[model samples]
Structure formats: C-alpha cells, structure tokens
Target: MKKIFKLSLPMLVIISNVSVGISQVNVDDRQSVENAKIVGQLHGLEGDTLTLSYWVNALGLDETSSYKRAFAPVEQKIIVAKDGSFSVRIPVYKKLQYFSLKSNRQKTIWKEEYFFRKGKMDDISTSASVPVLNWSYFILEPGDDIKVVLQHGQMSFSGTGAEKIKYLNEFKYSQNRPKSFQSFRGDSLSTIKRISYYDDLQQFGINILKKYHGRISPMAYQVLQADIIGHCQYYRYSSASLFNSYKDPTIRRIYLNIYKEQVKAKALPLLEQLSTEVLGLSKSYPLFWQQRFKVEQSYLLYNAHGDGVETQQASKNDLFEAVLNLKKGLLKDKLIVMNCSDMLKVFGQVQVEERLATALTELQDPTMYAVVKRFRDDFSKGQLTYDFTMEDVEGNHVRLSDFRGKVVFVDIWFTGCGGCVSVAKAMRDKVEPHFEGKDDVVFLSISIDKDKRMWKNSITKDAKRDPKLSYQRPGAHYSGDKTIYLRTLNGSDDPFIKKYVTNAYPTLMLIDREGKVFAFSAQRPDGGKAKLLIDQINDVRKL
Candidate 1:
C-alpha cells in the first residue's frame, strides 16, 4: 500500500501508505476527513475455489473496461478452512458497490449487497481496514462479519508523477491473486477442465430471453452471467488506472481455455438474449474489448503473443466476427456490436461537440459509421476537446464546464508532443499533487495549438518547456446536469474544431460525473499510467 501526491496551498498532499496494523470504521461524515487506511493480503492468493471467478478482475470493476478498483472502504469475504486456510475481510464500508466477493462468493451469488456473517468469527490476526481512493476495500456491512488471511503482494503495483511511485509504492505481497497466477486469458473460449459453462453466454449476447433484464432472476442471470464472461479476465489487475499482469501458464491456460469454451457455449444464449431483449444493462458489453479486440483480433496477439507458424490471413468468419466483436464492445459489424459502455457514452458526447455528425448521431451505428465516427473523433475525442477554451497558471477560468460534478481529464497536448512535455510534467508534477485540492478529481488541459497565448506564456514562463498540466475537482466544474461539461460542449460548429479537423495532438479525454465520456487517448499519460488513472479516480470516489 503506497500512494502520495503533493501541491499544498489551500490543499492537496494526498500521501497514502498504510499496513503494519490497520483500523478504520468511518461511518461517513463525508468520509471522515477521508480516514486513510491500507492493509494487504488477498489472503494467500492462488486458486482453489473462492477464486470465484476473481471478482471482475479483483474489483477494478468492468462490465467492459475503463478501469478502477484499487481499494476503498473494502470489506471483502471468503470462507473455507478445517485447516485448509482462507477467510478474508476488509471493513470500511459505505462506498457504492463491488465484489467478485470472488464472483458472488464463487457462484453462491446471494449479494444482499455483499454478504457472509453467520456468527462472524475472527483471528487471522484480525484487523482489516481498506480505504484508499481507488477500489479495493470490498465493503461488507449489513450484519457485518470480519476475519481474513490469504494475503497478497510481491508488489501489487501502481505509482505516478514526481517520478517515483516506487513502482506504485511497493507495499507488496503475494500468495496468488495475480489473477490466480497461472491462467493466461486474453478473451476466453474455455478453460477449467474441458469447457462448457454457457460458453461466455452466447458471446455476451446473454439470451435465454435477455437473461432477466437487469432485475436479474433467470437464476440471477445464470450466476452473474457465468461470473462475467467465464470469470472476469481470469483474475487480477482489473484496471482503476493501471495494472497489467500476464505471467503465462501457457498464457493462463490460453485465457482459461478460451474463457472456458466461451462460457460453455455463449452463456445460455447470452443470458437468453439479455433476458429477452435488454430490460436493464440495456444492450451493452465490455470489461475490456482489448482495445477493440486488438483491432479485429490482430491475429490473437499475433498468434499467441507472436507469429510462430499459422497466419491464414484471418478467416473462420474472420475469427467468428472477431470473437463476436470482442463480445460486442466493438466490431462496427460482421453483424454489428458496439457497446463499450455505449461507445464510452456517445464517445464522450461526441468529443464535447466537435460533432463527428453529432458523434456519429450519438454513436448510433451504421457499419463503419463515418468510419466509427472518424475513429472516435480522431482517437478518443481529440485529446478530449483540445482547447475548447483555456486560461490557467491560476487565472482560472479553466472551464471544462468547471469540471461538472467531478471526474474530468480533457488532457490534449503538444509542447511539440515527443515525451509530450515530459509526460505532461510527469502528470503535472506527480499525479496532480496527489489529486489536488482534495475534490473528486479534475486533471484539465487543452491546447490543440491555436495558441492560448503561446500556451499561456508556456505555462507561466517555461515550467521546463511545458511539462503538461490540467486538473479539476473543487465544486466539480458546474453541474445542473443536462449531462454537464458545458452541456456536452454546447454542441457543434467550432464545437472543438468540427470533430477534430485540427487533427490529433496528444489527446486524453476521460470524463464522467454526468458529463459522460470516460476514455480517449492521444498518448503519454504514463507516470506508471497515472496509477490506472489514479485508480480510476479512486474508483469513482467509491461509486
């Protein structure tokens, strides 16, 4: 456990590191001055049952994949031990919700909002308090229960800015949840002793009449849809910014035997077609369509991580319409798919109105739809509407709609883009002073090059030739919520250069808090990948 960020004036010196005895109960007085607490031990990582399909890749939360789930008021649980050993807990509670609790307690799927409290016992040296910004606290209340062991580290990494995240502050541990250590799964077709568990529920079309449409029942949507496409990315590094582990046990048994033979033949006709025609969870998909299935199965990572022998030039219906367009979070078509969280919320409201025909008519779809809305308005909404407006160095008009209820990145670039202003000044002198001024988040920036006064006098007289900077949080921009961010950038006509006609300049876009849009990139955000976007804005401020 290690997190730190500095920039004190009125506030912003985050500094997170704990473990060596932990404690925190925090009922939430707006998060009791935040009450920082860090403790590790996925218990004794490594699989045997409660790997419970590794809880959406260990709470980084992914119905698709924008990434988040580091560790927050966590309260996770698991049981088994006559002497076998395995009883985990993490109490801090009062965050939104998350839990693979091991994928609904390894398919026991009860979820009264996280469970396990028979007579609540303890003694794995009892004491678990997790509450960092990103997700990992596993919140467990309602009849609360505590007791854990199964620990973790060998350095479960993350770090950023002032340059030494110490590789994300090495609070290290590991017995095995590196996604269970031995299971290579890029997208899944089958694994776990000869496949058959609903074969990724009809490649996530989840049919049996649309698997009970959101209220969930066709037996809890065939057990959380075969625990999210046959157990969420085989486990570990579920994103909340950056954590990518691969360890190869033949590539985690070929991604758990092609996600256990596509969740035993497309998880009950895609949960009966989203329990017959989308009632809830609408018609979406992705927890990671591997960046659009590596651009149409870039030959399955070049035929198993590189060209060894075969290369028939892609066919088997183009690899089953590229694994059904990476389970519908992509594929402009062989039959259509696109849902990656509604194309990252209409491509972040069509790049705040640089209107690629209203962001391809709000990402509706028409096959190569304006070539996928000019490739998501020139790669993720032109570095997030590069300079729709600006003025910083503290004069502060700033305005990405004043950050609108939090979570905003905007982040375009060009100090001549190479190491892009030293990775944007090491993400603004180390992760924007560990989430500056202590609001939910706001990392601003936008300079496509019209010359905001030579980039505001090169960010106040060459702060080392513009090392990059942008941030927002405090009363979060401004949000009466017509979907904020300047009402999604007012909507067109110079609307951020009529959909990127100015062309790409280190784009970064990421927006949320009602403004929609969550990710887009022109490149260079890696101060250890802003520790997975500061653990997905500390897991959306714990939902």
Candidate 2:
C-alpha cells in the first residue's frame, strides 16, 4: 500500500559504529537496559549493519515537519561482529509499540530510471541504489528482553515475548508472496479488478493472523487485524477518485452498485472491530489509525452520494461532521487532532481556530489537544520562514533574506520529478506572463540533485537538440533568467532539505514581502489553481 502518513523516520545512514563494542550500556541507559534489550546472534552477516527503529508517538498524529522534529523515531545501528553476535538496548515505551529491523544490505532499484521524457541512455540513466526500506516488524514494550537468532537472513526468536515476535515474523513472511492485479486504465473494469484485488489481499492477511491466533497476545492480534482491514479500506477509499475522471452515466451507475454491494458491505463489519475502546492499540500502528479516519470519512461521503441526497447538513468533505458520527471517546478526540492539518490546509487559520475552539468544548480526552494547539500557533500566517543560502548557476552565493522585500514564490524539486516539470511549464506559459516585469516578485527554483555536472547540464541546453532530447524538462524550462534556479550543495544530504522539505517534491511556498510565510503549501500554477495563485501573489504584495 502507498504510505499516506509519511512518518519522518530518519533515513540518514549513520556511519557504521564498528568500534562501539557490543552489549555495552552507557551510564545514562542503565534504567532503560533494565527495561528493554535485544540480544541477537547472526550468521553470514558479519560485514553488514542492523538498524532498529520504533515510533515515539503512538497515535501517528505527528504529521507536520515541526512535530516530526520533536517526536522522530528512536533509531540505533549496530555492526555485526566477526562472531556474528550483537546486542543493543533501545528506549522503552509503556504501550505495545511496533519495532522494525532493517539491514544496510537492503535496497531497492532506483526510481529515477528513464525519468527523461524520451527513453534515453547515459551514465545517469542506469539504476541507482536507493534505500527503500523493507522492515521485519515485531512488538516491543517496557520490561521485555528478547534474544534473536539469524542464519542467512532467516530469523528465529527466544526469551521473553518470543512467541509474539515469532508469530509476527511468520505472518510477515506469509504476506510477502508475490501478488498482482490488473493495471489501472481508469475504466470500470480496472475499478472492479482493484476492488477484488484488495478484498483477496485483506482476506489473505487475516488468514495468516488467524493461524497464530492463540500464540500471539490478544492486543497484538487486534492491532494486526486492524492493520489488515485498514490497508484494504484505504485502497477502497482511494479508488473512489476514479469516479472523478471517468463520469459516464451508464458506467458510473453500474460501478456504484458494485461498490455499494461489495466494497461498502465488506468494509462496515471490519471497521466496527476498530472501536473507540481500542484506541490504546492505535499507537503501535499509527498508519492504521491514520487510514482508519480516512476510510471512515470517505465512507460517509460516498454513502451520501450513492443515496442521491440532495440536501446535506454539512459540507461534502467536512471532517468535523464525520468525526461527530463516531462514538464519544478517545478515538473521536484523536481523529480531531489528526484533522487539524487538513483543516489548516483547506480552510485556513480563521476556520481552524474556530474549529479547534469548538473541538475543545466537546473533547473528552485532551491528550492530543496540545498538538493541535501547537500546530495552530506555530504555522499561523506571517511567521518568519526559514532562511536558506545556496549557490546559483554562476556559483554566486544567494540568500532568501536578500529578497526580503519581494514576494517570493519558492519551488522545491529534484531532477527526476515529472510533476515539477509540468508545474514549471504552467508557470512559464500562464503565470509568468502576468508578472513579466514585476520587480516586487521573484521566482526561485531549488533542486536537490547531487551531481553538480548533472545539475549544470540539466539547466543548460543540449547544443544538438537531438530530437530525442527535445522534451521540455524543469531544468530546461527553468534554466532561463526568467527563473532564478539554484541547486542544493550536497543534494539530499543538505540539512535544509532533510529538516524542512521531507519527502514531497514540487512543493511550492509563498513568502511575503517581510520574508514571512504566507502559505506553507501554495497552489500550483495548473489550470485549476493558476488564477488563485496569481491573486495570492497580488494579495501578498499588498501586505
């Protein structure tokens, strides 16, 4: 499943701690050593490294870049000894937290292959080593010491909580079998095929969990079950978007009937199992919690549309109203916390403050209210945005603060992003003409590409204009003086890129005349939001 909540787990590869002798606990970790420990032995893995990571926040509401800084995952790496033995102590949590292990040898084929529009070849066109994580997950909590044994990538467990961990691993291995579904053609057949694929996938996962029912703790089993259901439900919800593009009357009617009969019918019973009382289990699987809310909200909206309800009490996508449909408990309160970002993005500050005020009145549990309040106060309009300095094409140092008195439109992107190129085309063709000679505004494009030669070549023209290379890319279109483009000093390793711009590319931000943020996520210059972006620029200038 595509990850909806981009957990800001640090992927920054730490230098191998080869010298940090195994089983050595620091004085400060004496208490944690008593509480939590993992002792493991490995074979055929003496040269590789192992990384252990676990979430600090259980509810997965750490959505913003700032929140992630405060509650990032606690990750530690240990290099295997020649004897194939290693030991490490990790921080403990009160709840049954989900912990995962990954190896330095693990990697995915590069996602940037053939990013150039034309199927082309070059030193850069071949696959690069990207760290796409495939984690082996297990449950960990306070007062647990587990010993693990691994031989040639096969792992077994013993000591406290061994059965639970063993069962979790077994379930993971079962689900890793190769599966495929019909490719999306944005038609009725594609939609039906997707729904059937997820249905079978969810059932397959549930059967695996059932096989180990008594062997695993009830809490662990419940969480795993919710995860299986949530994953399938999230896909069902995402598939609803297909109706937006292909709106044939006859096809849509048949699609809605199949959806109501099969999709909705299957999801309701599964969703019921994830009630408010089980909110504590949510922390161990934050993605499950996040997907649960999305699934619930989509169910309500689609139900209303299917019934042909002309008059609704609330707006179509109003999450607050959807939350009200749930029982009064911690689940309701936490979902409200998760909805704060969506409100801020869609309705802006005034509505967010008003909603939070109203939410406070109804909140039965305030554990996450602080997060909502902090997000509201910190990202409020007019906050001075982070200042960055980088080298332009001429190697001249330029700082964001230098353009303090101008309205700055910032685009954060990298070499292989297609959306960035499309947005650049839209900006060049549509938005730039209006601000052609405006001195009060600036267009800044920052790239996270690592190779300076590749960066330079991308921005400059191919003298040959090989018809094969005639495709319009962000670098080519953004190369001109009309746009001031700069590349990050160390590519993805740059601190600014790591800390602020996590994951999403083609991110657009609007900075006001005082170098304060007007919009953290501004609209793209596409057909739908181009006029609004133009108006936003004009409006920010007036301030």
Candidate 3:
C-alpha cells in the first residue's frame, strides 16, 4: 500500500517561509510564528468525502508561449463519518485569504469558500437543513469551545470575532442583490448613461461601506472597498466590450457611427479614476491592488490596439513597440510576457519568436524571465506527451502509450465544467461521426472528476441525463478497438495532470501517430473546429 504522508504544522511553517521568502515573527525564540490553523466540526454533511483547498496564483504557459494567470489548488481531503460529521484543521498562510470546503457524495458535491486569517482559529459549522452552505466563523484564541448554529440561512457565531463575521455576512447579503445592471441590452443606453450607471454603482458600494462603519474589522472593510472598486472597473470594461459587438458587423457599424468616439473618450477618465483608487489601496492590499491594475491595463491595451485584431496581426517591431510603451514595473513585465506568449500561441513560434526575443530584453526580473524560458522549453511542439495510466469506468487500466501508432485527440476535463460537457456533446454529435471509420485516429476523454460515480454516469448514460436529478449509470461501456474511451484520473491532484500543466478545462490536444504532441492546445470540438480537426488528421496521415 502507498503510504500517505501529511505535512506537520512545523514542516508547513518551514516550507511556507522557505518557498515564498516572507518575513516571520518569533513568538518565544523557540518556535517561529507561521500560518494560522482553522479547526471546525462539520455536522450533517451529506458526502462521504470532503476536500479543502487554498488558491495560489500560478503562471500558465500555453502552446503559444503566452503566459496566463491560473489559481492553482493546494488541496487536502478528509473522510466523513457515517453520521454526516467530520472534524478538520487546515493551515492558512495569508492573513486574508480564501479557502474552499467541498463535500463530495456519489451524485453531487457542495462547495463553499471562507475567509481566513493567520494566528487565528476559525470554528465553522453548517447543517444540511440549511438550503445553502452557510458558514459561521469565530476566532478562537487557543482555549475556546467551538460551535455555530445554522438558522434560516444565516450563521450565528458566539465566540471571539463573532461581530465581525456577522457584519461580513450582512455585507455579503447586501452585495447579492440583483446583478441586472451588468447586463447590456443592445445599446439601448447612450455612452454617457452607461458610464454614469457604473459610477452610481460605485457610489452605492461606498454607501454599503459607510453603513457598516464601526461593525466590521478595518482590514475587512478595506478588502471590501478594494473589491467594490475592482468590480466597478470590471463592469465598465465589460460594458465597453458588450457595446462594441465587434463580431456583429451591423451592430459594429451602428455603434461605431454613434458611440465609438464617445465611449473612447470615457475610457481614459474611467481608467484614471480607477488608477487613483487602486494606488491608494496598494499599500494595505498589494495583491488585490496588483490584480486590479493588471485588469485595467489589459483593458486599456485592448482598446488602444483596435480591440484585438491589430495585436493579433502585429509584426515583431509592432509587438515590441506596443509592449515597451507600457509603464515599467513587475506588473508590466508580467503583462508583456503574457501578451508575447499569447501572440506565440495564436500566430505560432515562427511569427512571434522574434517579438518574444525582443520582449525578453526588456524583462528585468529574473523570476519572470525564467517562467517564460521554462514555458518555451516545456510547451514546444513535436515533444512526446507525458504518459500515464488511468482506469476506465470499469475497473480496468488503460495507458496513454496503448494508443501508440495512432493519432490521439485527448480531452482534458472534469465533471463540473460546463464547457467540457458542451464539448463532449459536440464530440458525440459532430467529431465522432466524421471519424466513424478512421482506424488511425482515436478520441480519448480524460475526466479529472473527484467523484468516480459522476465520471461513470457521464459516459454510460445519455449526455442529457442529469446525475443530480436522475439515476446514474453503473459503469462505462466502450469497445476496445474503435478509438473512443472514457477514463478518469485517480485523484483530484493526480500527478499526470500536473505533468501536463492542464490548468484550463475542456483543453483539447491532438497527438501525432507516433505519440508526439502535434497541437498542444487544439481547437474545441464546436462549430467548424471539429471539421478542422479531421482535416488536420488527414494532413498528418499524408505526412
């Protein structure tokens, strides 16, 4: 049997300090202070398995060498008892960070996030009687009893820091009001009206902060303030994209005639206002502020370069000129790496390599430059994909190398991904039919679903069957030779997934006949892309 090794608190403290190089305060000179431990008793959990994971910002390199931000999971699992109860303690490194608690049953899973702080114990509990997963957080200082009650969809806390949690709950509830303001209905509103609407929302958020003035912690209040500002900026940027409708020629012509210049006029002022607010909040909340800055910069750049077309078709000199124009900082360096990497993916290595080489010269941070170099080394084409074994819905094992000598189209997905389901439907309706008789081609669906039953249900039953609402199929049934196979990763944190860097859901990849990766990130199985996959397969066959 494989031995399971858990990280002790001391080990976690050492690792966290060493890996991130964050400062540490000595409490007694014998033990250095580190992450806070959260202990909780969960009652009325419907699932047999529970998963706890925290988010960390990770840099992802796509097939094009473009860098994208991904929140990678550092997860741990707990076993629930027969009476729907479990006790767990999780360590959190950041003072203000988010952690998810996921309960997995045979048919369904319940997941929710809780805010945490280091050097504090958060005792939270929830019951199945509550319609939603509502948590009551309380700060415990070494020697306090832990308990929380779920009443009428609200959590009641009685321990230390209870008032703060109550205020947080109220704030969360207030923010949950209808999001209809975000929706844009075909340019019914003028450009000025749209900008004013976002401004009003920003003011409304400020009013929320003022209403809860003395009730919440100062840190929590600042975080909420930053969140509101970020949301307002995002809404304005998103509204611009919606109003433009670049894909719809008729809408584009109509919008450009009336509101194009007016919208462009408002963009700079809005971004400038956001910049002032973000800069003010940067000292107290650097990460949140940096994230907001990144988004705003992306929007500004997107608008400046004719939306996306100019950037997509930009030459090496044009790309460098656009990148170098941005203000110098770690954020700007990251953005340049991201854009250059994206260009490489969309335009291919030959077209974007010169531009990437030029951009690398501008990168002052060794860590960021190393990320780009590692991505380039790992994601290059014609490289052999990481081989691994996974079990089919039945108890049988299947190896990736088993499909050697045949071209493989691998679909990396999970049960909860809606995009993955839609692509699966497309594969069933379109891609599968086109290659009905192809012997050299194969379709492999690899699900990283934590629940085995969900994976089995998806393949054996109709695509329309809802596992939550209906009965699940017992196991998958597939012929050995026809190329279509449904397989599941052994666990949520499977090494195979980490090796492939399969961060995005519904990621498609096409493997050459000799098991070498042809397209590291292939087109989704939707629209005419399915036909394109067939064409590529035929072209590969000839070669």
Candidate maximizing lDDT = 2
Off by over 4 Å in 1: 1-223, 226-299, 304-422, 425-543
- Cα-based TM-score, every candidate: 0.28, 0.74, 0.56
Model 2 poorest ten-residue lDDT run: 20-29
Which 10 successive residues of model 1 have the least lDDT summed? 159-168
TM-score attained by model 3: 0.56
CA deviation > 4 Å runs, candidate 3? 1-69, 76-168, 175-201, 210-224, 243-248, 253-325, 328-330, 333-374, 391-396, 413-438, 445-483, 490-505, 523-543
The whole-model lDDT of each prediction reads 0.34, 0.59, 0.49
Q: After superposing candidate 2 on the true structure, give the runs of residues whose Cα lies further than 4 Å from its correct spot.
A: 1-34, 58-72, 107-137, 175-182, 246-255, 267-271, 283-316, 324-330, 352-370, 394-397, 414-419, 449-480, 489-505
**TM-score ranking, high to low:** 2, 3, 1
Candidate 1 has an lDDT of: 0.34
Candidate 1 vs 2: which has more lDDT: 2
Candidate 3 per-residue lDDT over residues 1-543, each given as its tens digit: 321222122223211212120011111222222343433344555345655543221222111211222223345665655554555443433233333444564223222322223323233433333224432222212222224443443455555434444554554455443222322356434433555555666666677667777765555455456555555554454444443335565654454443344333543332244443233222222233333343344344445665444322333335446557766654455555555545543444344455556666776434445445545555567778778788875668889899898888887776566667677766776677777777788888787766666666666644455547443333232212343555555654465565454335666777888878777667665655778666766666665
